[model samples]
Target chain A: MKYVLIILALLTVLTVGFVGLRGQTSRQPPVMVFNDLVDQPKYKNQGESAFFADGRQMRLPPAGAVAWGRTPDKPDPGNLIDDADYYGLKVIPLPVDAALLQRGQRVFNTYCAVCHGGFGTGNGVATNYGMSAPANYHTDRLRQVTDGYLYQVITEGKGLMGAYGPSIKPPDRWAAVAYVRALQRAGNAKIDDVPQNLRGELEKQP
Target chain B: MHDRRLVTEGIRVSRIFPKNSRQIAAALGLGVVLFGGLITAGVTYYFTPKYTRVGYTPYQPVPYSHRIHAGQLGLDCTYCHTNVFESPHANLPSPNVCMNCHDPAKGNIKGDSPLLAPIRDAFKTGRPVDWVKVHKVPDFAYFNHQIHVNRGVSCVSCHGRVDQMVEVRHEQPLSMSWCLDCHRNPEPNLRPNELVTKLDWDSAKDWKVSPLTQNTDSQEAFARKMVKVSALHPPTNCTTCHR
Candidate 1:
């Protein structure tokens, strides 16, 4: 009983000592020392003086006054409607413009014809070189796609074809998409009658 | 025999009573003191402001006022802190930028202007002014000024009413949890893309022009305007804040 009493007394004393020490540490204010005026040691002659001898001085620019380069007000192509159909996210129909088709045809011969062939039936020079066969643009899937979606696939590049974004600017890329759609339509055309100008050439071939 | 027995019993009773009472009294006294000390210590820890080695309130070379530029003049916060909406650092303006209008000196100095001394010194010495930072977050915390600014988080949300303040105080606690609160449930008042940099829109009397307009002065209007609309959205992942 006597030993238990002594042990308890010792524990109590230790607890009190710890509490007192903690209190003392908490009360002490944080020290802040302002450095006296001296030349910035890093650059001797060119250093900014730490303190000004004359208190009267010119006004500095306000805080947060950094000038920024102006961003141009051009439309963000990322938000283009063409992206809707490409991801199978949305379908926005665009009018079939002859000018767009002509532009598209030119772009296709330059870019797509190297892989998909001029006729677009997957017999391009790339296929002859043992590259992966380009898809036949006349497939039902291609036909069903909205013009916007087709444009997105061409501009952004789908599957094996890397994005043409770096090589083709926006207007040219959109033209290329229109051309692909034209190729698909031409391939699916029925051979009921050839154009009047082309009939004579067909007869000579036979 | 009766007298001897009574004397012996009294001596035994007295010894037991005094020693036991003294022990009990001492134990109670010690327990009270210890519990009281612990309560006091806990309270102090809870209430006291935590200070860092690089103290929050470092003396600035200039006493520039955000209140004048952003608050009263109704200038866009991004007008000066150009990269605040794009870069990590809301970079300090160069002395040349200040000299654009201020070389002529517009405002009258009351006694000694805190801002003027640094500018004059920089002009005389051909040295860049070294302004001290206020509202500094820990280095480990990656806070993007662009993300917040673009997402429609008002300058006032983090910096408090800086325009109202003469000498910018570290108004917000800027604790991790304080940031998380806004991230978790962003205020609804966030504006649309085009109007992100315009603060004058807040005081505009037009609401019919767009749904994004700030017509009403209610807290709800402000909260609604801060709604998040971004590609990344508002990421709550640990690496978002920690790294």
Candidate 2:
């Protein structure tokens, strides 16, 4: 009986020791539990800062700071327009190429495809998810709009459409404009648009 | 007291206790202690939030049914989560996005249902709906959705079958070790970029059709080869997640 009790006591000690070895709860570490950096003395954005003379966290730019690279003062080459046509530009200022169209397609797929289907038919899958039907690019009205106008609509957003300017860079937006034009042209492709060798096969699709 | 028997005795002490009752009582006590310890550990292990969070469905402002939209109708995950590929954060659809189909003016579908009151209110008021977050990591950990997505990790890898969920719930224990298990060996989970949004996609089935794996002997070998070709290297260093 004594030996049994002795064994029980030893087992209890072992179990307790094993449990103790586990230390504190593993969920929350204790190393930096009460670190001062979490509650450090700091100024919030645009808040008052005692260290600064103006007492504002936001500092004004230096007096002679002209914005660098394609400065607003550089006279936009008269491509940009400001009128009732939704401030739509009259001409595309950037150079266009196959790479730019490819980039535009990628950007359009990533951003616009949810509303403007992959084929730009305005029948994107989002229409089933309780969204309004987006405008189709194949329409004659949209086709006549200048490239600048398309860029402006993409930049500022049109009607119920939200602006893509914040997410899409300006160059990519231009690329998208170029791609939209391509889609519009593709929608109304003439027999001449097809290659001479492929025209035979195209006409054979009775 | 007289029941004490020395261990050095030549004869095997078959009966140490004075009565069977005492032996039975001792056994019962030991059994209780062992079972008690086991029960305590078992309850602690199973009842902790980490383990229990799997089915924790929280109440949301709207009763949106992912099962109806995603399962029955088969809308892609990216239809609403528009910026999942380009941005670190998955962008929630704006009220205008909902208005695309549910516009009261259009009267297309479900325009008058009271269940869609909040959506209509948000659209009319230009206010955002407050959708509660289901899966959350510790504040210290940094997660970028775009990087994981671009690397061919499917949305279902961590979220489970969200299409079938009426209301989304926590599916996986977002623990450090749970992440390490995948980061250490990501080959099995890797899929083609096009199939990332396809929740029920099977890499094995794809092997037979894929041009890359047509000449390969088996699906397993092809998957491993594709993993090597993609150059997927999910880092495990602390700075990868912490800093």
Candidate 3:
């Protein structure tokens, strides 16, 4: 009995020595004991497929496919929409409130801050790497441009800029325009613009 | 007790057997019992999904570091995962997204590094890079990223502090019981929807130091209010996930 106990103890130590403790980082895939229908042979989104010629589960949309729902069609072939002035809207269609501006700021920081700078002063992080001529929102030319024109620029690439329409939806684009206007106003703020209650706080700032 | 023939007038029926056969049989029986119990306990301790799936770290074609991009550079999570809010799956970014910064143009960084060769090749060839999927669910399970994110479940709660990990290992067990642990009491994990992507937002640090004080009014208090506001009752039905 003593010998049997000693043999069992040595065997246990040997097994543990070969395989490290649980949760130790390993490159091997997990062992799924009794994989009962856990991994079926059905196609998954963005999964590999053996049946398809391209070996991709996701199929690209057929050529010239017209969208049925309220989806935006393909961007104009060469930077020219049908109604330039009409689509280049001067007014924001949505209600301009604090909530709208909050969302606009969130969207702007996520999508545009890398290239356009957080303060919209043409000094974004991308500019340090070689991004040339990110438009400064504080400039007179940008301040005077209509909201629709800004929307169009965001949807279509100007010069070396890329189109962000596919990523940012339409309402978000309008909100971003509103945020750009707010940034411009903030950059050119004067003492008179401060509210009477907050004037003391503004004066305290260096 | 065994040698009755030596004690009285009795015949020795099995002289070929060993004198200490009983003790030998008893020792063998006890050994079998001990080994049986050890095997049962070992299997129960080390052979489960929690043990097998916890630390599965796989190698990828591109050695992209979340520590650098998401942590040091402070890029928002949604910059690459654009469709997380809209789709069930948190889709991977295409190679074109990588070119936005590394395109060897006037001010791009590391345009010609051999490490980024696969990304450039995929971008030029219009082919997808074979990025290994980490954190996968069973085929029968239906996990939605949008509902969880939109309801203010931070990614850090499920995937530990990914920004700190050089290569993200399977931080959580992601077992069925683990899911129930949160579903039963989700207040601890809840935060503001706007700060869902803020992986490093520490409540105690923010409550004491942050100026804005967005949801700094005690984490439990905020989570309780959010539960009331969002009607946060995650179902515990097996069909909820198994479907």
Q: TM per model? A: 0.43, 0.65, 0.88
Worst 10 residues of 1 chain A by lDDT: A37-46
Candidate 3 residue lDDT tens string, B14-70 = 454577888998998999999999999788768866678888889988989988878
Better of 1 and 3 by DockQ: 3
Ranking by lDDT: 3, 2, 1
- Write down the TM-score for model 2: 0.65
Ranked by lDDT, the better of candidates 2 and 3 is 3
Q: After superposition, how far is residue B90 of candidate 2 from its true place, in Å?
A: 2.6
- On TM-score, the stronger of 1 and 2 is 2
lDDT of 3 by residue, A37-132 (tens): 877888887887778765578887666654443225643432233335335578877798898899899889987888889999878877776677
Top candidate, metric DockQ: 3
Worst 10 residues of 3 chain B by lDDT: B7-16
10 residues in a row with least lDDT, candidate 2 chain A = A22-31
User: Highest TM-score among the candidates is held by which one?
Assistant: 3
**Model 2, runs deviating above 4 Å:** A1-118, A122-134, A156-172, A196-203, B1-18, B21-37, B40-50, B68-76, B100-113, B120-128, B207-231
Per-candidate iRMS values, in order, are 21.1, 10.1, 2.4
Model 2, position B187, has a per-residue lDDT of 71
lDDT per model vs. reference: 0.56, 0.68, 0.79
The sequence of per-residue lDDT tens digits that candidate 2 reaches over residues B1-243 is 334455434235445544476778978788677667766875565544355445557777788888886776666676578668887777667666565456677524687888888888877774456566666555556788898888878898888888888888667766688889889988777766666777766676766776754566665664577668777778999999886
User: Model 1, range B47-142, lDDT digits (tens) per residue?
Assistant: 332332112344567767767655654444543454465566665555543442244342112314455767767766756677655665555567
Which of the predicted structures, 2 or 3, would earn the higher TM-score when compared with the native?
3
